[model samples]
Target: MQCAYCTEKAVMNTPPRCKNHFVELFEKTAHETIKEFNLIQEGQTLCVAASGGKDSLALLEVLHTQYPVEALCVDEGIAGYRDTSIRDLQAYCTEKSIPLRIVSFADLGSKSLDELNPTHPCSTCGVLRRKALLQYSTKYDLIATGHNLDDEAQTILMNILRNQRQLLSRIGPKTPAQQGIAARIKPFYLIPEKEIRAYCLLKQITTNFSECPNVVKSFRWRVGEELNELERKQPGTKKNIVTAFLNKHYVREEHKRCEQHFCRRCGMPASNELCRACTLITIGS
Candidate 1:
């Protein structure tokens, strides 16, 4: 398994950190997606959803070093774990001089994610996080997340298995901005999860190791494990899967239907009359 760019070293090793090579590889790939999808402009304010995990940390680092970016973290009000992750994230941001913002579920008047009525806390947390990110990011023109190829592949397969056609249509490198909100972008859409983890390790970048405290056992975990196994068996399987879906299965026009519109309830760009965040609150209310 030779390196994708350099054929000398095996792809799995701690790759050499040549600034030129690194910038060239990332910028070229990112520029291609940016051009193809019109993801961002030169002067756009980019907000990165930094989860304090390796992937998001790497995302923040890359964007801060390469482009204009602000690191945003959402705290789900999981008392013990959330504070620890925030402390570390703050330290990293302060050390690097990266602008940072913290939004808590408390600030949004939501209780702990574990207290949500939904069986899967992830559903509530995700909706709340997105809402907070959108609310806090007034100046940014784009919101970038650290979703890598492995995650994308796992999610695509998960959606397809569950017959989630609409969700499948929404899975890609680019997605519509919420009405009056910055568009979403995934610059690392082609990069594999393992590669991101490896890059973090090689760079010795510090990140939070805590998993989501309230995450229940779910099918997505099994799918993630399966994807990891497949990656081990066939290098680049995740990238290949995402590329295949983006090139062959993904329908741009069909996904355009997923475009964000103003929610009647919250006035936020939503897929429905009430955004997911408002709906969750209403259910809990």
Candidate 2:
């Protein structure tokens, strides 16, 4: 097959790119997104939420090459899942000389996964993980997550379905959740998942294939399956969904309308006296 950009042979088909071109394509697009979104400045410190998965592994590679980055891993204490992921992250960070900070579910409170009580484990686990990541991310100038196009698209659809206009407003690269929190950015926001996996394979980056065992329990995952089918039928549906939201002039205005105040309990940003994490964590197990 011939390359789409040039006459060099194509190494990937679906999108149609040559091996070198494919790599270049991925790198160039990420850089472009960073520039367009102003995701990272030249001298700022960056902390990545690396989960030892393909998305984050690929994200760390690109960011490490471009800036000084410290990797932070949140150990949610799930047996055989988060433990193995943190181990993978630890090894990779050590090998690459990147600083890795591990904050655990147990460290914050209890050490064992069995100790937590929640009606929805997967949903609760996600909240816990985000709280942990945000808590640890306090020291950095910016927090970069590995969320890609597909992830963003799925989230947009879910929020729209639920009429979560407030959450939908916070979909861009530099939207900080609340005061005192560095902005959250996703450099791969425009990159497709397929390309990330291909880049990981091409670069030979070591990453886990096994997803979190409890992922099937997520409402988001179910939505993702349906979204994938929609994407298969209608190419660029994901991009279109996100693009439409991002293009709205009221997005930033609506995001500012989030009205942040500190959580009286844990002191993180909260809409009420207690943050969602603090409120949820306090439930009887």
Candidate 3:
């Protein structure tokens, strides 16, 4: 195969990148995405949500080369999975001398995710984890995630299909800052997951490959499976879908209406009277 941007022979397949130019293309795309969205700016500290997975690891490695980044890990208290990944994340950050912080389910509430109702564990876990990330990120400029093209596309389709149009309003490379909330950004928003994996492979960045034990119980698993099949059949379908949404002005206008307000209970940013995390944590506690 030939490189997508050049005529030289290509070494990577998914959105094709040549060995000689793949790394350049990968890092260039990452930088361009950051600049395009102003994910990181002068005098602003960046805290990456490092999960020790390939995407997170790759994101940390790439960003660290250009900026001083602190890492944060959320331990959902999955007995085997989170413990193992935490070790990997810890080792990577320690070896690189980057500051790291870890918060757990126990720290947030009395019940660990394993103890929660098995039905829709991710729904509950997501609220908690997101809240933990955002809550801890209260001091930082923006909370960056390794959300690549594939992840973004699946979420867009899932939200639309679920009639959660409100969720689509927040879809973009970077979310504008709101009261009592740190802005969230996705530097890899336009990058393909395959490219990230390949970048990790090429850079020899070691990351945990273990799947989260709770993944099978999540709605994302089903949506991801279907989207993967669609992507395989129609290359660029994912990027096109997401790019179209990103370029649409009306969607963003509606998203802006999904405003933030302080939770009456915990005084953190919340859409409802009680922040979802605090609500779930209150139940779990």
Better of 1 and 3 by lDDT: 3
RMSD of each: 3.3, 1.8, 2.0
Poorest 10 consecutive residues by lDDT, candidate 2: 110-119
TM-score for every candidate vs. truth?
0.85, 0.94, 0.93
Pick by TM-score: which candidate is best? 2
| Model 1 lDDT tens row, 1-285 | 456566444435435535345545654665577678777778788889887787788788777876877898998877677777788788878888988888887777777675664577666777898888878776788889888777789888888789867676558887766556777788888776656776676667776555765554666777888888888898777778787888864457557665446678767766788887988777776
TM-score ranking of the models? 2, 3, 1
Model 3 per-residue lDDT tens digits across residues 1-285? 889888989888766878768888788898999887767889888899998888898889889989889998998878888888888888889888989999887777647888876588888888888878877888888788999998899888889889986677668888877665678889999998878888888888777676888888777889989888988898778899999988889677876677546789767667789988888877776
Clash list (residue pairs), candidate 1: none
Q: Least lDDT summed over 10 consecutive residues: which range in candidate 1?
A: 11-20
Q: What's the lDDT of the predicted structure labeled candidate 1?
A: 0.74
Off by over 4 Å in 2: 6-8, 110-114
Model 3 Cα RMSD, 1 decimal: 2.0
Q: In candidate 2, what are the lDDT values of residues 102-197, reduced to their tens digit?
A: 888765564344457455777677767877888888888898999999999888888888897767655766676465676789999998898999
